[model samples]
Target: MPTELPMFPLGTVLFPGEALPLQVFEPRYLTMVDHCLAQPDRLRFGVVLIARGHEVGGGDDRTGVGTIARITSCRPGGGARLLIGSVGEQRIRVDEWLPDDPYPRAVVTEWPDEPSDVSDAAAGELTDRLAEFADLFARFSVRQGRPALPVPVWADLPGTDGDRGFALARSLPIGAIDRLRVLSAPGPGDRVLVLCDALADVVAALRFRLADPGGAE
Candidate 1:
């Protein structure tokens, strides 16, 4: 049987193992939170990146695949709003969309991650590339004079396996749709290639930024 869950579509995609802190104020979402809380497990809901439109309104399109968000902490936010701390759990593929009179609901099937056939050497190289990407991004941000945002250390990620593909995707700066594409990838090897392609462009751009500050921005 497909698991039915409350869907909260936003402009951002949640990669498994990512922690998201969100504010819930919309009436429908408040009700959705209530539903999640009533469940036996800690309030768990589905989180999808909106395909189109904004997060503040109805009529937004959403991606079919998303991660389950397990609420870790919930507290009052000023008035009727709520401050929620959640971590991405499992990936799910939306099989059906239910009515959203109050809040979004969906029937989804589990889309568990599949490992890759990457050799030990390839895996180590991939991990090194991720770390290098982080260092480059941090340096680029500093050069741009933006507040320093440290890149997530790839080793700290759970599991020392192929799924680090998604881990790397979440760590780097990539487009929303691209991130979704990574999630939909067949296996870790594919996802790693996708991320590597994106990283190439980003690294080149950062180098350009270094050479001609006015040329790249």
Candidate 2:
């Protein structure tokens, strides 16, 4: 069934079952926050990827395929300082959207969740590589006086590993199109594979950065 949802077009993409922390300072998004909190379902907002143009006046052109997200936690950072944690649910296709309001509203078509097609061997290898990568990341963060990156529970939950991979794949400081490509992948194997490639890229980038803080020719 189609639903009319309030839209939060972000500069990034979100993956299902993954948590995203956001600071809501924009007036329109603050309105979105109020609406979501007041709604009965609590499933009031959809997180859309910013595709083109700026967030201020971009309209619907800024958003891509989105996932229904719920406001899991909300805290007041001060006067109008809103901190929100959202967990991605399912994908949705935007049918119609209207901009120029306090917040954008989109008539969306829900995309149901599809089961994973990843083989055990593939999942295992992916998990192993991801674990090594995550451990390295956490160690680096702690060594740099930053909070430690959480150890991803990659074994007990197969689906979660895929979700984590996809989430990190989108979040890395890579090309925008590559992030979109991961989001648009066809199926579970394809998505996981894409994530693996992204992880590899991140590892390579980290090595390069550590080797040379400046882009030395």
Candidate 3:
């Protein structure tokens, strides 16, 4: 069954098990936060990627798939703005988008990953590939005179294989579209495939840059 949820369309994608921290300054979102805080037990909202347009002020195209963000903490920010700390808990598919009556609302259904067996070896390979990708990207960043991006500590990853995969996907410094592809994957096995492809592409690009600083064929 589909249930109504407060929708927050952002320029980025949020994966399950990822932390989401937002600064709420807009009147509409502030109201949404207040409403959620009022119902402590139901302090949750949906976060979807804005296919087009800006995050502030309205009028944006939103994707149908998103993650449920459960509010863990809320406090005041500079000048009446709100600081919210939340974590993505589950995936959801939007069945219908409601009007922005002060805020965006959607009728969505839980979209859990389909069960699939992921062998220990397969999981280890994914992790190794992710590590390689991260290392190459970091080197590429430094070569471009930018600060090296931080890598996630493998020891701190989630317990289950599926959860760890989602965490790895979330940590990837990919673009919104690519991140959305991972978020929209059907199951853990499929998601791993998508991630591996993305990692390969990135690694290749980084290798190219590292080889010939002048990005040429």
Which rank order by lDDT, best down to worst? 3, 1, 2
TM-score of candidate 3 versus the correct structure, residues matched by position: 0.86
lDDT of 3 by residue, 94-177 (tens): 999999997999999999888866666656666787789878877777767788767765447767656766887777767788
Clashing pairs for predicted structure model 2, backbone only: none
Task: Please give each candidate's TM-score.
Answer: 0.85, 0.72, 0.86
RMSD of each: 2.8, 4.1, 3.1
Residue pairs in steric clash, candidate 3?
A: none
Worst 10 residues of 3 by lDDT: 153-162
Worst 10 residues of 2 by lDDT: 208-217
Per lDDT, the best of the predicted structures is 3
Candidate 1: C-alpha lDDT: 0.80
Flag regions of model 1 displaced more than 4 Å: 119-135, 138-142, 145-158, 215-217
Q: For candidate 1, list the clashing residue pairs, or say none.
A: none
Candidate 1 residue lDDT tens string, 135-198: 7767766777776566655456666444566776776778887888888876766776666667
Candidate 3: stretches off by over 4 Å:
119-128, 141-158, 214-217
